[model samples]
Target chain A: MKPVYRFDGFIFASLIAGLILTIMPLPDAINAWRPAWPAMLVLYWTLHKPERFGLLGAWLVGIAMDTLTGTLLGQHALALMVIAFINLKLHLRIRVFPKGQQALAILMLVLVYEFLLFWVDGVAGFATSGIARWLPVLSSAALWLPVAALLKGAMVLARRA
Target chain B: MAGLKPTDVLPGRGPALGTRLFLLLACSILLMVLDSREDYLQYIHSKLNIVVYPIQAAVDLPFALADWASTSLASRRQLLAENRDLRRQQLRSDASVQKMIAIEAENARLRALMDTAALMTDRTMVTEIMAIDLNPYRRLLTINKGSSAGAYRGQALVDAFGIVGQISDLGPLSSQVLLISDPEHAVPVEINRNGLRTIAVGTGDAQILNLPFLPNNADIRLGDLLVTSGLGGVFPAGYPVAEVNQIEVNPSQPFAHVEAAPAAELDKVRELLLIWPGDVQDQ
Candidate 1:
């Protein structure tokens, strides 16, 4: 039987990796295309293990992201909270979907995440207009499958250990 | 399949999801409002930034390793060639320094005769950039120096070419610099050719700055050099800021559509010099 309350170092490691990836420097042209790793990680964890990773964890991770990226404090926290809340509410339905449908669901979640960020940016007076603002949503969706697979593989390894 | 899973029923024990979400949302809004409107959160941010410094260093490790490997693995012949090129450049600059010293002495004597205050040389320290903000619109850079090294907020920074930016946030180990090319940044500048003063505002593109206040009949022209007038007391006087590259005078518009290219390579700068402008001593 799976240990219901075992400490999961794998989750912590994955979260750290996600934060690192979010702030990793890229070239100007490709920077816009970088995926929103924190949002994806929050969605993934909250979907897979809502009991452990809930709104509080998501909010804390978002705050870390805000600090790392130097955005207005709480900007990412608000977005990630909204995404995690939605994922928690519908995880049962989403979990049963096929891989393609799962990817589509993840796409929608990422879109909502980016939209919240864009809206917050507008309200904070740092609004930037262009296709660049929406580029990460598409990239995050495309990369979701591989990222999920990688995280699942790590989890499996951790469980075996 | 009909048996209810423990995981499904377990999460409902806490405060309802809606209440938790609403509370978190309210907390976020409060933090944002305080951060944007006041300096209350800056102290907390600076302390929390210590936790973030390691992650930034780890992210920078790959690039740092590449730079180290390239330098350490270079052939002797290549090193010799580089050394020779640097020596030649140093010699050229040394000759210019001699001329500059003579001109400076003459200028000081003239200033004394005119009863004007003497110019003081700014003190500067070199710092390497640790990270660049991923958000293209923000244009912030994190440098290795911080309060430990006398870095303070609003301190001016420059590269080898010209004015780069100013320090906006300070941590114990590192600080964030707001680049002059960020859309929100503006500098007071005057034309080197005619002393026609105007404000050079950032356009979100590192290569371009807009002079929105220049009138149609302003004595600004293409290829004109822009230098800091030191009117704002934030930047030192006579620092090269940008060179006017485009000018359009419209008969209908009240202000001419003028643009200039930044003197510093804002997008590619890997190192910057943090400057402390010398105080003008009163007689």
Candidate 2:
């Protein structure tokens, strides 16, 4: 007899880990450079398994992130749902591209995510903290290759079991 | 790939992406508007926070363990030295407190004779900061004390040096504080030098506070101490707020460019005193 690895369980674990990483504290100098973990996870899952993780899942995760980060409710929800939507539309074309090209797409997606956030903050009259807010986009882009590879490896192992 | 079914290899499609996107976007927009316009969602947010608290605790576990290790494994000599230093600092603080007590008594008597209101006997609860806001645009902190500890919105948070911030959101087991250094926050303060009243606004920089709308000829100068004016009733009177570090006055300009260093260690302080004002008296 062999054990079966559930896709739902695998996705759940990765999302939870993503949530933790999204809120983990970092030093002041590099905190802004921390990758957008939940966004990246949403991109990967939406790209790989669009049926399992969609805009709704991204919205829920974003709301939880809002609560965790203590920001205005729905701010991240709006941004992440948009990200998920874009990823869903482009997932087919994106999945076939090489890792480097995929990372470029991820960069554009993350930039769109951050831009939505910045617009909301502006309308709310919140002061922008220099240009450090955009650092996460670059970091998230740099992180996509490894994150996608890890998720791919995990899915393969889970399916084999 | 040989063993897997065609369905297993292909991505399963979900609901119409466009429709789902539109619906979620509308719902999210509604939520963001409600959250910003009213305090109606506070309880819901607080309840949702409970679901996420465990994750936050898990993230903080490593730091907590290291802190515990350091405290538990310190050498006897180091402990003794720390104790000696604390004792000496306490003695010096005691001397200043003794003088404060006499001055407060005199102030009370004078107020009574003049038929003015007396100061409330403020009670304070010590709380440790649990988390800090990473978004540099917003200055906020979550503290361990909450509604369970009698924490309420608008309660003043202070440190040994001076006032730090105010409790903005209260939860069951935790509360969020808006630091005084937040760009959106402003505190009414009086110059200790000439009793000049002004509003000190945060400049988005940790060390600088902007004193806006001051007359170019206002008797403010560099190195003046600013204390809470208690005008808005948000903060009590007489706590140190900031020290004037730079003052630029131009004859052509209607206002002076005044910047001050916040008296409280806003960036570094870990412990805060949650002040609960005891009573309200009519002046």
Candidate 3:
């Protein structure tokens, strides 16, 4: 199947939609349930087509997140780029994995991203970054099924076309 | 003839390696510099919000519908009960206000006799809480009132109970009110029962506020009620701010680490009043 149709306009638009979700005003109680939509969407696309979308796209999307969420600048950008780079490196082997294992890989990638964030902020002495910040990784994993299905649907549509 | 063989070049290398990394590093450094020291990002913070606002509104759709459903489903009996309760409470408040007016008159007379400072009545505006600010660590809420509606920066937001925080960020349609419980926010307060003054700062944890610099032997009791001292010219005096919850003293340290709970129901605040004194001669 041609990679051109799946990873171009639709991918960029999807990333923006994910950013919209990231900025959506959820109350404190429910915010923990909000998945890391942008990270998941970007990583999925990067794994699908590393040739068209790569580290730069992920980094830029992350920087947009940083600006939108008003967090430590470049933190998400750096994390996203690393996620993309590693996923791209594993795309060949990862593509053959069972659905469950693939989901596990995504979880590991998200955990790595969270670890980087923890290391960076912990050293900076801004206390109370809190246990809550890392909760999104678990939430993102729980959200993986719908995301994988959506991406698979898009890929199937492109193949039929 | 001038071209080098392909093997000489690194496989992963893209053009202008140093320049790209330099630009990336430089841009982020510039961003950090602007965000922290220069405050240049505030303009971007203000304007880009317009682009993001539509998406935010769309995101709030489910919440709005939920609120609508709950209100619409309220039984007529419940509505009547609520109305009756409100009316009874209003009457009780009116009677108390009448008594307060008489007492205030007596107070003015006594103050005139003694040549003492008189109490000032603050002008206030009612503003609806639109939504909480997206930053989880920062305790800020957006109020429906804005510059067009006569809201401005540095104005304190309060409820019937006591002070919440001041309007720190202003937009055209709404203003961002940072809560007094934010780590960066500090309110000058006095213990009304004993007249002990201290500054209560937000501790970044939503549940606790810190009162720094109270002497280890400061005449503070465990349950002392704290009120705004009116030292900053922002908040009015005699409004409840917090109740002293815990105090820890180290024998080596001169000051005690005093913690108190916030006066307002911050997590549950749906509506608040913007307290602006009408006799703001400075403005």
Q: What is the TM-score of each candidate against the true structure?
A: 0.94, 0.92, 0.78
Compared with the true structure, what per-residue lDDT tens digits does model 3 show for residues B1-283?
A: 1353443232245634344445554665566555654455656655654555555456556777888997899999998999999999999999999999899899989998999877767777787766565545667766667677777778988877778889876655666778998776899999988888889999876668898889888988778888999898888777888888998988799899889887877777778988776444342
Q: Compared with the true structure, what per-residue lDDT tens digits does model 2 show for residues B107-157?
A: 999999999889866778799877888787888888888888888888898
Q: Residue A7 error for model 2, in Å?
A: 3.1
Task: Tell me the spans in candidate 3 whose CA falls farther than 4 Å from its real position.
Answer: A1-9, A20-34, A49-60, A72-75, A85-101, A119-125, A128-130, A154-161, B1-25, B103-120, B128-138, B142-150, B174-176, B233-236, B248-253, B277-283
DockQ of each: 0.66, 0.55, 0.29
Docking class of 3: acceptable
Candidate numbers, best TM-score first, in rank order: 1, 2, 3
Off by over 4 Å in 1: A5-7, B1-9, B279-283
User: What's the CA RMSD of model 2 in angstroms?
Assistant: 4.0
Cα distance off (Å), candidate 1, residue B176: 1.1
- Candidate 2 is graded, for docking, as medium
Instruction: Output the worst ten-in-a-row residue range by lDDT, candidate 2 chain A.
Output: A1-10
Provide the global lDDT of candidate 1 against the true structure. Answer: 0.88
Output the chain A TM-score of model 1.
0.94
Residue B50, model 2, lDDT: 80
How accurate locally, in lDDT, is each candidate? Answer: 0.88, 0.85, 0.74
TM-score of chain B of 1: 0.92
Q: Estimate, for each residue in B1-283, the C-alpha lDDT of model 1 and write its tens digit.
A: 1364765547886589999999999999999999898688989789878988888898889989999999999999999999999999999999999999899999999999999988887888899998888886788888989899988888999999899998888888988898889898999999998788889999889999999998898887789999999889888989999999999999999999999999999989888999989843343
lDDT of 3 by residue, A1-161 (tens): 23343447777777878987776667668886677787898778777765567667877787766655545567677677777777877888887788888888888888887786666455444444666777878888878878889878976786677
Ten-residue stretch with the least lDDT total in model 1 chain A: A1-10
TM-score of chain A of each: 0.94, 0.93, 0.88
